[model samples]
Target: MSNLTTLLALADSRLPTGGHVHSGGIEEAVTSGLVVDLASLRAFLVRRIRTTGLVCASLAVAVHRGALSASAGESGDLETDARTPSPAARQASRAQGRGLVRLGRRIWSDEDWDALGPTPHLAVAAGVVGRAGRLADQHTALSVVYTTMTGSATAAQRLLALDPGDVAALTFDLSALCEQTAAEAAKDVTDLSDPLLDVLAQRHVERDRPLFAS
Candidate 1:
């Protein structure tokens, strides 16, 4: 397949990675009343892109930079896991990683998924898939950032019944920011953390009536 085709497939929400079920923490944020409208949702997304979004993009770039060996790949996964302080966040990452790897194996039959070991982080899975599919590091990073934004945006619309056009506009405003963040992430894999997001994930997991698995 061509690079564009591969990227489109990977970015498709229909890829069945269980990404749709999780709101990227938006559900928890809504439950906590942190995001009740377009303005708050935009703020949440911007913070997310700068923190975990950038971190995930960096890890994906690291993988594309030739950390393909078993040990090196595991190191990359560990690095991402360390930045995620919440147990719920780790579980969600691993779940998405497993889903992506499962789909990736079917697409790129030659690559060895076993080397990534059990419960690879989502960033590691994206990197492996991106490398195998010949996607550029920029595209990989942007896709991660894009999904990070869209997942929560979609969730907010559902949870708050916000205007779809307004939600879309909010995401549109972040295009340049996402590009800039992706470029910076490609340059260095910083250990950035969002404590509030971690706390939200922990709370989400402990809820008796959780809306999302994250």
Candidate 2:
């Protein structure tokens, strides 16, 4: 809430970091004709947010609460199980995690750097730090969700000729979806569980390099 600068820096696409590189399988989807237009792109992003992003946000809360300890073995195993449906998406999630953690140590680490590692998944790692920053769970969830959408959209714009205004409005409109997804993810049950995303992620890994790392 108070440290908007920190949040923005973490979420910004222009941070010299490589957030713009990976498309979370959007590139592959687009290349494979799974996503072709503004409407399709918007729908893809929403569904991704609701499924993958939702699970990530939920994992963040779970990690923050100590309800789900993210030791390398535990986190990896959990992510693996969650990712059995889509290995590529899972790889993308971890790629973002590595990128975010590397950035986190540079920007956020001080005395609390100890809690920075361990998490192999980006969302859980981000939640740990966000919670440490005293950020609300919902706010933390939104930050992660928006960051992901921004990254994917940035990737899309670079690869296509869509209207920037349309993308901007889409991002704004999708914020509502982020809220709903985050809210659902915060629930006590399997708030983050999504079948379609899991499958897509696994399928993403099966394909060779077309576009998008994840």
Q: lDDT (CA) for every model shown?
A: 0.83, 0.67
As a TM-score, model 2 comes out at 0.82
TM of each candidate vs. truth: 0.94, 0.82
Stretches off by above 4 angstroms in model 2 are 75-84, 111-119, 189-211
Task: Give the lDDT of residue 89 in candidate 1.
Answer: 91
For 105-201, candidate 1 gives per-residue lDDT tens digits of: 8878899888887768888888888889898988888778878778778888988998888888888899899889888888877788999999998
Clashing pairs in 2: 85-198, 86-201, 86-202, 87-201, 87-202, 89-201
Q: Which regions of candidate 1 fall more than 4 Å away from where they truly are?
A: 68-73
Give the C-alpha miss distance for residue 59 in model 2, angstroms.
0.5
